[model samples]
Target: MELGTSLEKRKVPNMLKRILQYDVQLTKKFVDLALRTTTLKSLRNHAKLFEVSCHGIVWLACWLSFIWLFNNKELYQLQVNMFIALILDIVVIAVIKAFVRRRRPVPMNKLMELGPDKFSFPSGHTSRAVLVAFILICLNPISIIFYPPLLAWVTAVSISRVLQERHYLLDVVCGAGVGLLEGLFMALIWFSQSASASILSSLSDEKLDGGEYHV
Candidate 1:
């Protein structure tokens, strides 16, 4: 029994190592193919557009700007929740990236200079894309017609990460999974309209008067 248990323990790690090596090689092949197929500068630039659209900083700025401009209660609540979701997404991503510390498939020295951390086990952009899409679909804040386009955006964002050599295939796959879990968590602990409003009001140091804002 002791011998059998020792062998089983040894085999499990070896199996995991083999799987990791295979994943790396496969991701390299896909990245190489993408580079060859998208040799054109314009094509590469277009893929970058998809990447930038789903960047964490861009999402944060856009959501905050929308909240500042729109006062509709429904819109306000949605924006506030989204803002909170983004923060949660950032915290989760940061924690995982720090712990994993995996290198990007392609070394981006310039990009690395822009950010302190260079780990890329899970694609943040892909996670953000999936999270946003899931939230929109679940909430149905916009017309049903928008869901298809939202899904397309998520697909594009995910593919763009691999094509750009910013992340491995497994990184993106796991990122989507993480994003789904985060969305489900957000749904479970979602704030009510009044709660959202009160939180925002407190942050801005504004008072509510007779169930209305007076600032």
Candidate 2:
């Protein structure tokens, strides 16, 4: 209800809004061109391939192993950043899940035919896709190579939610917002921690020098 109301209140041009609605609906019905949500199907497939798959544990572990082999400082920074981001992702996802309890499309409108009728208002699958993609892109500028496939997968994930009667357009949009913020805030947290460590190390060096540098 809140998601729908917020979307209704947006200041979109009438024609564009109508066009968008039609596009979304048309995309939803095209089973031949897309995959709909199914725990045993689309979502699971992404979990196998997408970064941050399997609740992000797989992504983190894989990144760590790769980083250890490559030993790049910049990659290390991003790993730290995404580590923070994943934590924020968990916090935001948990809070939203509890606060905005909306039924899935199937329950809200019985006539809607789809699969995976569960949880609305911030699709978890969308959240995972967005956060993982955000982190991967930021970690390496060349990660742009993954852009097309990553974006396609994210689009597919969002479409699956709608087609599967699991979420509304608004839910997916807001979930993307939350996921993006998760990466941003996580980067901030990493910078702060990195700064603190630097400061602490500097103080230790000073102490070891007997309080001052001996020229």
Candidate 3:
């Protein structure tokens, strides 16, 4: 019985190792196929456009600047919550990437590499895309007519990560899941207009005029 127990414990680790190896091999095969197929290659090239659109730094900077400059009462709640959510997304992605330390499918140029950017287990762009889409759609930030485009953007961003050989299939999949969870978490702890205003007030010298704002 003791020998059987020992063998079972050893087999568990071997099983996990095999699963990880299979994942890597499968991702390599898919990336190679994408490179060889003309249609896929073109799609990958186009997908690069979407990748640039969802860059984390750009989104954060734009949102932060908007929050500081515009300060429109109509968009106060969304702007604040979204800005905070973006920060939350960045922190979560950075923590996970640091913990996983998974290498990208291709080595990034040293000049472009940033902290946590070298890891590939979860695509930061994918997560950010998903989080933004979820907020825009579920939160009804804009007219419902924009839902389709928002969803399409998220889908494109997620697929582009894999097609561009920036991440494994599992990485994109897990990223979407993470983004969805972050959206739900933000919803649960959603800041009220007053809460958002107070937080923003503390950060900036801006004072809200005596007016009611609705989300």
Candidate 4:
């Protein structure tokens, strides 16, 4: 069983790498077409705004605001878990980018300002965006209401990473997957603790209300 599990793990990465290779070719063609077609002056100007949104400072400020707002202990824990997940995503992306050591697309000036990140196997911006969006969507009771606009923003962020030439299509795709996995991991840990606490609280309430005495 262990051998089979190990084999499956090895196969999965190999499969994903093959998919990335094909995706790169498709993305190159698509990006070429997009660049030629996107001639609108007004639209071009807005790309910088999208680029600015991807920076670390913007996310840091947003997280700080959330930390300030969620003062309740339970809510505070949730926010902290999310913050940790974002940090994990960043660290994982940094390590993977270093290991992959993939080169960025040339003519660096065409990329959005702030130059380019050192390597580009996976997009940190796309990952962080997806991580934040996924956590918010899952944690909120009114996620249905948030879904449409939130997904639009997520899609825009992913596309921007590609169009700006900061990442290939596969990088954004893989980054999104990684972000989701991290979010789910944190959610499970947080919720499990919450469930256990609720159970303990209920048990204590029963003992007190019933006036049960232990020898």
Candidate 5:
């Protein structure tokens, strides 16, 4: 339940009752395995849905957008901030990939192996997508409702990475973790800067008052 916890080993109490929506003990017990299998299989099948949640692509698009509007030179401040967030997310992802140094899930393996590459664990797509989704929601609360499709898109992307034989599930999940850390780091920086500015402003106001008294 903690923030950034791996989706694995994420147990659900009363799985049959909750998933199947039948609280009857006998029926629940009877259908537990079926329900569990059905739910997991369905989710894995749809893992492709979360593919778009990749940080690299999302940040690259954001970078392109920034460049596209660069000539205007009057872009909204929010765009600037998003640009910074994108950059930060990317750097964090790269650093994490290097540190983790995991292997791809068996390339071309019938069950796994989609895209084979050097980096694995913590899906970069997942992390970036989640970060973008968070920022978008912060800028406009309404965007939160759209998180489902976005999350699905990101998950699909993660699945695609597997299908393409690039990354394993763990790699994708780890990418998501790095992204979360990046977002949190950005938020803390913004808040700290804002607080410092406020304190400086107060000090300035006090100095002005002392000057006026002397005058």
Candidate 6:
């Protein structure tokens, strides 16, 4: 009847317990808000389609098109830079999700489909949307008229992740941060070097009169 000294149980440290309790409370607040916010119902209804658009097949098609355009067009650096940045974003998100091992917010039954992805600390779809949007804004390849709409779309995509209950608020926040940093990092290196040089050369040539340096 000794019971082997009750297995010498050790309690979790108070600090860790407090942190966990805080996280649970915060998650609950977010979940409650999402449930009550009726404005997001449209996105919630279409959220599965939005989520699947970020799947690997869509990304592959995009990259393949970029590769073709890069080879045939004059925008080699821009296309290559975007392609590489997207690839990097995918790698970074995948690694972070694996390392963190955070579970998705929605139950398996609520999910649209159960596939390769399960863990969801940082929302990969949100990250990719932010990264792509950031790249286009920085590069300025498209007309200014299109930027606002593109930004709105990106915002909607990020919100849809939460509305669909696939991710918590913090997951999208961290994912956005990671994506923005990646975009800035790529822009600083790629745009500052080759892109800048090409742009400057074009500007200088436009000012040239007879091949001598213009004052």
Highest TM-score against the true fold, candidate: 1
Error of 5 at 93 (Å): 1.7
**What TM-score does candidate 3 reach?**
0.80
Each model's lDDT: 0.78, 0.59, 0.80, 0.68, 0.54, 0.71
Top-lDDT structure, candidate number: 3
Clashing pairs in model 3, backbone N/Cα/C closer than 3 A: none
TM-score of each: 0.81, 0.54, 0.80, 0.68, 0.52, 0.72
Name the regions of candidate 1 deviating beyond 4 angstroms.
1-12, 35-43, 107-116, 205-215
RMSD per prediction, one decimal? 5.9, 9.3, 6.6, 9.9, 13.7, 9.4
Clashing residue pairs, candidate 2? none
Residues 1-215 of candidate 1 have per-residue lDDT tens digits of 99999667655466767876887899777766666674533344577789779989998998887777666666657877899899999999999998777777654334622245578878889889988988888853677899889998898888877766678788999999999999999998888889988887776543233244565
lDDT, residue 143, candidate 6: 72
lDDT of 3 at 197: 75
Q: For candidate 4, give the lDDT of residue 188.
A: 65
- Give stretches of model 4 more than 4 Å off: 1-24, 36-45, 69-74, 108-116, 140-143, 191-215
TM-score comparison, 2 vs 5, better candidate:
2
lDDT of prediction 3: 0.80
Cα lDDT tens digits, model 2, 22-74, are 74565345532344435435653443243234344565577556534543334
Order of quality (TM-score) = 1, 3, 6, 4, 2, 5
Ranking the candidates on lDDT from highest down gives 3, 1, 6, 4, 2, 5
lDDT of 3 by residue, 1-215 (tens): 99999667656466767876787788778767877899777777787688889988899889987876676666778988898889999999999998777778762324432344678978889899999988887863778888888888888788778877778888898999999999999999888888877777776654454333434
Question: For all candidates, what are the clash counts?
Answer: 0, 0, 0, 0, 40, 0
Q: Could you tell me the lDDT of residue 196 within candidate 5?
A: 36
Candidate 2 has an lDDT of 0.59
Worst 10 residues of 4 by lDDT: 203-212
